[model samples]
Target: MNAPSSLALAVPALSLKDIGKHFDGLEALRGISLDVAKGEIVALLGTSGCGKSTLLNIVSGLLPADRGELRIDGQPAASFRDWRRIAYMFQEDRLLPWRSIRANVAFGLEAERSRRAERIVKAEQALRLVELDGFARAWPHQLSGGMRSRVALARSLVVEPQILLMDEPFSKLDPQTRAQMHQELLRLQRFKNITVVFVTHDVEEAVVLADRVVVLEPRPGRIRAIKPLDLPRPRIPTDLAVSEQVRQLRMAL
Candidate 1:
C-alpha cells in the first residue's frame, strides 16, 4: 500500500462513508458520507423525519448503520473502539430528578468507571466549563430551560469527548435563550477543540451556528446541499451576509 497522504494524517474527528440506515422497512438515510474535522461545527439541516436525528445517532454509535463504513480518528470505526471519545446531547435535558446537578454531570464518568472523588472533581470542572458551577448542588427541576441545557452540556463534556453529537439540544429553549446557548456552544467548542455535529430543523439556527450547513432531502434523506458559511465570529444575525445566507438556506430547503 502507498503511504498515507499528509491530509489523511490529519484525521477527521468523525467520518461516515456511504452510511445507510433503515427502520422497520422505512429507509431513514442513504448514501450518507460526511466528515467533521476537529474543532469544526457542522449542522444537519432539514425538516422533521428527514433522518437528521437518525444520522446523529449513527455518528454517535448509539444506532448502527445497516450499511457502509465509518471511521473515527483515522481508524476503522469498529477497530478504534473507544466509545468514551464521543458524547451526545439530546433535545431533552434528561437529567435525573433525584440527582443533584453535580451528580447528573458526573453520571457519565461513573459509566466510564471513574472514581467517585475523581468524578466529582471532573464534574465540577465541566460545570465550570459551562458556567454552572454555582448550581452544582441544585436539583434539575430548579433550573430554567437554558440552565438545564447547560447542565446537559456539562454532563456531555465531563468525559472530555473529542466529538459532541447534539440532537436539537437547544430546540426547546426560548428564542433568546436559544441564541445565548448558540454563543456559549461556539465558545465552548472553540475552547475545547471539540468536533460537533448537531441536527436542527431551524434554518436560521443552522446558519448562525454551523461552519457548514448540510441540507438533507426529505424521507430517506440524502445530502441535498452543503453550504459553507464564512461569517465572522460572534456572528450578527441581522448582518446582511447572515440574512442573505439564511435566505439562501431557506430557499435551498
Candidate 2:
C-alpha cells in the first residue's frame, strides 16, 4: 500500500482549491478546499442541498466549478491525460437494460474487441470481488437492490481507476443490507488500496467507513470540520466505542 507522506501539505491523490459553483445566480458551493490522500477513504458529510453532490460532480467533471481548481495526484483536471484514472459510482446504478452484467461491467472496453476478452475476465473478477460472480448473465431487473448497488460498484472497479468518487451509493438500502455492504466495501478497499471520496448524508455511515470525515455546511456550502477516526480496522459497527464515537461525531457536526 502507498503511504501518505509525513508533510501535512503534501500533494494529495485528489485536491480541490478554492472551488465554487453556482446555478441560476444561486451559489451552491463557496470556496471549498480539500485534499484526499491515496488509499484514504474520506467521507463528505452534510445535510440535503449542502452542495456535497455538486462538489462530487465537479471532481468527476460532470459539473464545472465556477471558480478554483481540481487536481488528481498534483495534476490539474484538464491534465488528467487518461480518462481511466477516475471512476464514478452515482446514486443510481444506471445500468443499460439491454446489457448483461458482464457486458455492463466491460462496457468501457467495447471498442477493443481483442481487449474485450481480457476485459470480460477482469469484469468477472470484479464481480467476484463484490460477491456477485454468478449474476454475470443476469439482467439488471433480476437483481435485488443490494445486488444492483454491487453491480454499480463492480462497473466502477472494472476500470481500476486510481480515484473513486461515490455519491450516496448505499443510501437507499435497508439498514441490514447497508451494514453488510459497508463490510464488503471495507474488504474491497483493503484488497485494492483504492482512494475513495464518499459522499453521504448518514453521519453514522460516514463515521463507520471513513478514515476521516469532513462536515460541510449548507447554503453556499463550505467545510465546517474534519474529524479523524483512528479506530482499528475490521471494526464491528455495533462496538460500543464505535457507537459512542459516531454519536459524538454527529453531535459535533
Candidate 2 lDDT score at position 2: 42
Query: Each model's number of backbone clashes?
Result: 0, 0
All candidates' lDDT scores?
0.88, 0.86
**How do the residues 1-253 of candidate 1 rate in per-residue lDDT, one tens digit apiece?**
1224478646777788999999999999999998777777899999988999888888878788999998999888788788887999989999999999999999989876657999999999999999999999999999999999999999999888899999989989999999999999998888888888999999889888888889999778899988888887778789888999999999999
User: Across residues 1-253, which tens digit of lDDT does each residue of candidate 2 receive?
Assistant: 2465677536688989999999999999998988888889999999998899999999988788999999988889886776566788888888888999888888855644557669889999989989899999999889998998888888888888788889998988899888888898888888888889999998889878999998999998989988888887666668888888888877877
TM-score of each: 0.95, 0.92
User: Each model's RMSD to truth, in Å?
Assistant: 3.3, 2.4
TM-score of 1: 0.95
Clashing pairs in 1: none
Off by over 4 Å in 2: 1-10, 111-114
Model 2 TM-score, 2 decimals: 0.92
Query: Which ranges in model 1 have alpha carbons more than 4 Å from their true place?
Result: 1-9
